[model samples]
Target: MAVLVVGGSGFLGRELVGQSLAAGHQVAATCLTQPPDLVGPAWHALDVRDRRQVADLVTAIEPDVVINAAYRKADWSSTADGAAHVALAAASAGARLVHVSSDAVFSGAAVRYDETSVPDPIAPYGAAKAAAETAVTAICPDAVIARTSLIIGDGGSVHEQRVRALATGRMSGVLFTDEVRCPVHVADLAAALLELASSDHAGIHHVAGADAVSRHELGTLIARRDGLDAAALPSGRRAGTDLPGPLDVRLDCTATRQRLRTELRGARQFLGH
Candidate 1:
């Protein structure tokens, strides 16, 4: 299969690109600035915010599947408009689209959300993601909108790095005990996405991990796995703070899990805690 992984330079995108290449697919990737020593997949310069640029690239590649993993927490154009552009381009190219979304779309008022749950975003980032989801769904009704949670790699993820920094007293921040989310491993998420891409499944699918854990507990797990002082990690509460996000948002992946061959293991299992 010919696959186009947008934002191939990102953490999740890198995993998806590598895994797609490993699966013997003809892979092409897009990035703003080219990454050095990137092997296998053909790289293209793309600004997903530019409608014409997105359309031209997808038209030229003519990929069988397009996975969009591009987003900026603060940039609305990149997260929302970029998604719309990718969806339009993919639809124009007659390619299967898998738009990566976030559990942040939910406000966590109900705590646990299923595939049928509507987005009630609170923060700007969550709102951007919700807007992206809306645009993707409207543009490509056949597209799979896979909503995932905190993506963690073995040791390369930003969250893991933060845990290390906090444990080592390098970063002055606290992992909130009140803030909770389902954390999915990058490999599992990438594999599940590919599986969905090859399948006939469409519409919203929750693709998060099996376990929902608080930020502090997750940090402790990371610290323990990395041989850091778990007790040294500072802890706090986001409830009373000025933080703009939900306290607990758990995605129920029961339906999605039944469809996927890939097992979405919990953080405690993957982190080896």
Candidate 2:
């Protein structure tokens, strides 16, 4: 099977590309700013925001599976509109699509969000993601929208780096004790996404870690996992502060667990206690 991974240079995208290649599948990857470090997959320069480029690439590649993982912070055109373009192109070309989404799509009003939970985004990023999910579903009904959370693994993710900085005294800000998320390991999420690319399951799926933890707890866990000073990381609350949106967007992955054989382990298991 030929697989096409958009945003192959990104943290999670890179892992997907590598895993796809290791699984002996023909892989093609796309990037905008930085080129992918691996040499196995075929690389292409792509800007998903451009409809023509996306269509042309999908037409030319004709991949069996196309995973839309491309994202840009604070760029609606790239994050939201780009996802629509990709979904349309994939649907037109008759390729299966796996659209990566975030847990931020929900406003933390509910105790826990399931696949059927309605999106009530409060922040700009969350709103954009919700819009992308809508566009992708409307454009391609068969596409799987994998809603994941804070991706951390092997000391490379942005969340882990921030915790590291705080532990080392390079940055001085308390992590929020009120804000909670189901932080997933990048490798586990990547594996599940690849598996879903071939499956017939469609619509929104919560493909995240099993445990829901607060931001402060997550930071402290990362600090301890990396042998850093966990006590140095201070804790804060999101109740009174200017922080926007829902404070606890915990995802329920029971549906995902039944769908795939991959185990979406929690941070405590992956990072170790």
lDDT of each: 0.95, 0.92
Residue pairs in candidate 2 whose N, alpha carbon or C atoms collide under 3 angstroms: 108-246
TM-score for each candidate, following the candidate numbering: 0.99, 0.98
- lDDT tens digits, residue span 21-40, model 1: 99999999989777636799
Given candidate 2, what's the lDDT at residue 92? Answer: 95
Name the candidate that leads on TM-score.
Answer: 1
Question: Where in model 1 is the C-alpha error above 4 Å?
Answer: none
lDDT of candidate 2 at residue 9, scale 0 to 100 = 88
Error of 2 at 128 (Å): 0.8
| Candidate 1: residue 200 Cα off by (Å) | 0.4
Which consecutive 10 residues in model 1 have the weakest lDDT in total?
30-39
> What is the RMSD, in Å, between candidate 1 and the native fold over all Cα?
0.7
Tens-place lDDT per residue, model 2, 1-273, is 899999998999999998999999999999997785689998999999899999999999999999999999789999999999999999999999999999989988886989999999999889999999999999999899999999998999999999999888898888998888999999999999998997999999999998889999999889988999998998888898887777888999998889998899998889896
